[model samples]
Target: MKATFGIKERLKSKKEIELLFSEGKSIAKYPIRLIYREATTEKNFTIQTAVSVSKRNFKKAPDRNRIKRLLRESYRKNKYLVSKNTTHHFTFMFLYTGNKMPDSIIVESKIKEILQKFISKEIEKQ
Candidate 1:
C-alpha cells in the first residue's frame, strides 16, 4: 500500500462529519483523542481522518495550524497499522486536547498507540 496521505484519505463530507461527531466512539491517548466509527458509505479507502486543534488552547492561528500539521503527519506515518488485515471502512476525527504544543515524537507515539487500540477494537467487533 502507498505510504503517502493523499486527498482521498481525508474526511471532508459535511454529512459524514456530522454523523461522526454525533455517533462515533472516542478513545484518548493523552494529547490525542480519536473519534471513529464504521463507515456507512461504500468508500474504497480503509480509513478517512480529520485533525483538529482547539483555538482555546492555541490562540494563534499558526500555532493551531502547526499542531494540526503535526497531528496529520503522525497519523499518516502510522496509518498502515490500522489498514492492514482490515476489511471495514472507517472515519476518524483526531482532536488535540493538550494545553501545550507537543513535539512530533510525542504526537507520533500517541497516534501509534491510538491506532493500535482502534485496530484491536475493530478486530473484536468482527
Candidate 2:
C-alpha cells in the first residue's frame, strides 16, 4: 500500500460520525484519544478517520488547526499499522485532549503507540 492519505479515507458522513461517537469504543494514550468502531458500510478501505482539537484547550482557530494538521500527518504516515493484518473495517475519531500545544514528534509517537494498542486489542478479540 502507498503511504498516502486519500479522500476515501476521510470520515465525512454526518450519520456515520454520529454513530461513531454514540457507539464507538475509546482508547486514550494521553494527549490523544481514539474512538473507533466497526464500520457499518461496506467500504473498501480498512479504516476511515477524522480528527479533532478541543476549542476549550485552544481558543484560537489557528492553534486548533495546527494541532489537527499534526494529527493528520502523523496518522497518515503511521496508519498502516492498523490496516495491516486486519480484516475488519473501522471508523476512527482522534481527539486532542491536552491543554497545551504539543510538538509533532510527540503527537506522532503517541499516535503510533495508540494505533499499535488498537491493533493488539482487536487481534485479541478475534
Candidate 3:
C-alpha cells in the first residue's frame, strides 16, 4: 500500500490525546519526549505533536504557532520512516520540552534524532 499522511491519521482529537497519555508507552531522549500507543485500526496510525512556547517563553501566539507548524511539517515529512517501520497499528505523541523556540533546521535535526531513537525501540520491540 502507498503510505501517505492525512489529518485523520494525525492525532488531533482530544480523546485521542488523552488516550495516548493513558495508554501510551513513553520514549524520551531529551528535547523530545514521545508517547505512543498501538492503533486499533488495521490501516492507520495517528500522531499528535506539541511545541512548548507558552506566554512565559515567546509571549506571543504567532511565534508559538510558527514553531508548532514547523514541528508538524518536519514530522509530516519524516513520518513515512516511522509509519513503514511499524508492523502494527500505532499512535505517536511528540512533546517539545525545550525552553526556547529553535530554528527550523534545529528542530528538524532534533526530530530526526528522536525518530531514530523511536525506530530503534520499535525494532527492539519486535
Candidate 4:
C-alpha cells in the first residue's frame, strides 16, 4: 500500500479543476461532487477537496477550517484505495455542497463512503 498522498494528491489550483471539468467527466452524490480526468502519468493522481459553508452557515474561518480539516483527514487516510484502482491515473476533485457543517465523524464517514463509490465507479468504467 502507498504511504502518502504527497504533493500530487492535492487539488492545489483552479486550473487543474477547470481542465478536468472542461475535458474530464464528473460524478456527484450530493454534498460530494467528484470530477475526474484521466492522467498519462503512472501511479500518480491529484485530488482537490472542498466543503461549502456559505456566510449563512459558517461566519468564521475556524468553523470553515474545522470542516475542511475533517474532509482532508478522511481523504488522506483512505486515498490509497482510490490510488490503487487506477489503470490510468486520474485527477479528482471532491466538492462539498452541503448547506452547513455537520459533525466531523459524519463528514469523515461521508468522505469514506464517497471514495468507495468512486472506486466502484472506476470499476464500472473499466
Each model's TM-score, in the order given? 0.97, 0.97, 0.79, 0.75
Best by lDDT: 2
lDDT per residue as tens, model 4, 1-126: 665556656666677567877997777666656667775455444444433344555678887777677767777787777767765667776666677766767766777787788889889878
lDDT of each: 0.92, 0.94, 0.70, 0.67
Residue-level lDDT tens digits of model 1 in 5-98: 8999999999999999999999999989999988998887989999999999999999999999999999888888988858888999999999
Clashes of each: 0, 0, 3, 2
Q: Whole-model lDDT for model 1 versus the true structure?
A: 0.92
True lDDT of residue 27, candidate 2? 96
Query: What would the per-residue lDDT of candidate 3 be over residues 36-119, giving only the tens digit for each residue?
Result: 877665544444444333456666788778877877877767877776686667777777667676778877777877888888
Model 2 lDDT per residue over 21-121, tens place = 99999999998999999997789788999999999889999999999999999999998898886989999999999999899999999999999999999
**For residue 121, what is the lDDT in candidate 2?**
94
* Steric clash pairs (candidate 4): 11-47, 11-48
Using TM-score as the yardstick, the better of models 2 and 3 is 2
Using alpha carbons, what is the TM-score of model 1? 0.97
